[model samples]
Target: MPRPPYLGWLAATLVGLFAFVIRMLRLGEPGEIYFDETYYAKDAFGLRTYGVEHETVENADALLAQGNHDIWTGTGDFVVHPPMGKWMIALGDYLWGLLPFGAAMSPTGWRVAAAVVGALSVVLLVRLALRMTRSVLLAASAGLVLALDGLHFTMSRIAMVDIFLMFWVLAGFTCLVVDRDRMRERIADLTAAGQHAAGWLGFRGWRLAAGLCFGMACATKWSALFYLAAFGLLTVAWDYGARRSAGQRGVPGRWLLFDAIPAFFATVGVAFVVYLASWIGWFTSPIGWGRHWAAENVTGIWARLPEPVLAVVNPLRSLVHYHAEMMNFHTGLSSSHDYASRPWEWIIMRTPVAFFYNGDETTCGAANCSRAILAIGSPAVWWLSIAACLVMIGWWVTYRDWRAGAVLLGVAAGWLPWFTYPERTMFVFYALPMLPFLALAIVLALGLLMGRDADDPQYSPRRRIVGGVGYGVVMLLIVANFLFFYPVLSAQIIPYEQWADRMWFDTWIYGSSGSG
Candidate 1:
């Protein structure tokens, strides 16, 4: 009904900037490997040193802390996850290593990429929210809530690849949203101008971009496959609805012929290409695990192929076997972990993973001091989002609101798959990717509460006032909750009593509450 709120861009910029700075501030505190950092930081250094992750010297963590850069044992390590995320960590190493006193072993050097990507996710979410709501303030609120989220903040400051996975998944979803808007606009305009059947609406650039985003996401973590499938189906459903609304005949068949086929090429085929490209390091490296599997073990169907064809097919076959081994490892993993949580407990903030903990560091002005980095989310945000998601589900079922359906699908894709692997050991940070969509659910719920914009002919001031007040209160609670937990989230040195006081339940304490 009116010009789009372009001011939303400015708000997004400011929020993103704030998020980036805050994430980077004190990022190197404690200055040692914590939690999975023991694996990823060293693995990143190995990738940078050897092109593939290399086995490290015994007590490599201790050696790195002692400023030894020569920790390579000169053998490839059999890591579970893909190399793309390790490569992302290695980027920080490559850049920061150039500076004096900054090297791959430095916590800050390896962790920089996570903070940057995590903040960029906030920026992307703000813009996506703005596009969905057409409201400037609500968009910024989404960014702010995401920024203030304790889980997001903690994950951002770590060197783990989960933050990278979160960023790329959000990026892919954002690209799809943009494509939806552009395609729908084209169909509406063409139909209104008496062109009911506008075949092949040129190249959908945004959709292709989404493919690249998802490619990078899956490269970061195979779990991204869930989101890729969900979003692909979503965009296709949108295509069928758009064509049907435009009065085009045979909507289903038309969609299958034009939209579905092209979309498959754009997203699935392109994603496959990108996923292959991410393995260039491993493919080229002489020491990559299983790199020579095909050549070493040619049998059955492989033995039937001609030598010429076998040469060309060797690498692909090796990669397939590698993937199979990875799949087996993932499915069979049932290692007991203190902080392992069920998918249901993740939403309720039941058990938080303590990333770093130390009472020996003498900094606090108390005899008994505690310093820790805990990856727990703000309770206010998570609890309210559950209610917000409920409201969104109602809107989706009653009115078929595309935004609501999209948010719900995103949450389901990120979360539901874990239920199938109830035996798999999981952590709270694995739920990080779902946080952004919940933030959107909260914003979308607010929009439904407010009805129409103030300038609308029948806008309700009372509704706006009520919704605005409710949103403001929730924002306050989120900020306060985060601030209260900021000490533990950032590994700040606080009195032991304060740390114990912050723990409302025994499950929240990941380790012994040692006396300083």
Candidate 2:
């Protein structure tokens, strides 16, 4: 098929924007905090009031809604994650009044940021897929799949950190891809001009941008550290491959000496700096917990340092201690919950958590009522993506495709690390960062099924008809599945019978639909 120049990108953006609008619509309704928002939203409010998270009164949610901002008791709250994600949530509160519309901290405003980021993510995935596959159809298909996926859609509509983590990590990955292409072109141009021998490429601005993105990702969640590490290795490998492709000998050692070490410092080191920078507010505030640690313990190394340097170093030391406490909480968390799930079940979405559920016989217009916001993955998107990943593995091993390698790197970076903490409490929502790569895998698998244009003439007429029909049927089924489950995913009021029917299995009804 002939590609439409930039129309594909424009179309993808429109689709993504539409998806975003749907997520943003009625975002503030169901005024009570949904599920984990109870923790994050309140924490964000605390962070804003005090430099550190403050303890809340019993039944604080109700109290805060009644124009009571003094929920904090001045004691530090023990939170598991870093402050950056909550800071983002606080941005909405900052803009839309400490309590907007007088209906409990505008959920719409808080979630709108996530919705926008999710929409931008769709656009980025589309462009990245297009560059990787050189197929506009595949790129658009990938974006459409993500735009429609229930997991992505629900996360976008909620005030959560995972969405931010997904956005920045994908942004960093996209920047790296752009950097790769630009480096290749520059090397080719220099070689053609015969200006210099192959060695170091000077000051990569794109890579620096990627470093900033990776830093933002880390600030959102420490899980982003895995991606940063994987991407660092992947960049070096790309450099080594580029050198070898250009006929340079000893490319591995050369990459290690000239590219790998410098990239390690530039990417990881820069990321560390940016991550620390995000804590500037807490550092500067005198009331922040542990802010006076240096003053309290003046005989240590921090005391020996100049007062100016101590001002900088002390905050970092406090932050490190805070992180250690957070890490311990994460490691020790083993409390049993009805919705807790194993990583193995995440791939199939066996048990999805219901973030919100409220319905009455009067409101639902049925014997039993059901209104819910389920964090479920679209079966067609995820299940087919699983098959697509198998195809990717085959392509990587049999044909040694670099694109497949890159896609797998994304999957592994976001996924494989979870298995290490099988005993630690984790959620299916953590899979959000890897969903973009799964969408790409699905597109690539479709490309394989569609076959190349050059081979069109060789196929028998019957085979072509069968293949086209099969593809059409699959697409139709996927659309039907999404439509059937839309009410539950969107928190629409429905009869209990209808909701049960849509559940498709007992696990979904039992809050075990691990689809987040």
* Cand. 1 Cα-lDDT: 0.88
Q: State how far residue 89 of model 1 sits from its true place (Å).
A: 0.8
**For residues 1-516, what per-residue lDDT tens digits would candidate 2 score against the true structure?**
226666766867776787777777777766667888888888787777786666788888787667576777856676777778878877766776645453335666566667778888898888888888777767877787888888998888887889889989999999899889888787777667774456777778878888999998998899999999999889878887777777666667767877899888778988998998877767766666566665667675666789898776767777777787778888888877667777787888887777888766357777889889889889998888788899999999999888888888898899999888877766778888999999888888776676654456665656546656766766666677778888888888889889878888677766554333
Model 2 RMSD in Å is 3.2
State the C-alpha lDDT per candidate. 0.88, 0.79
TM-score of 1: 0.96
TM-score of each: 0.96, 0.91
- Stretches of candidate 1 off by over 4 Å are 1-6, 99-104, 510-516
Worst 10 residues of 1 by lDDT: 507-516
Clashing pairs in model 1? none
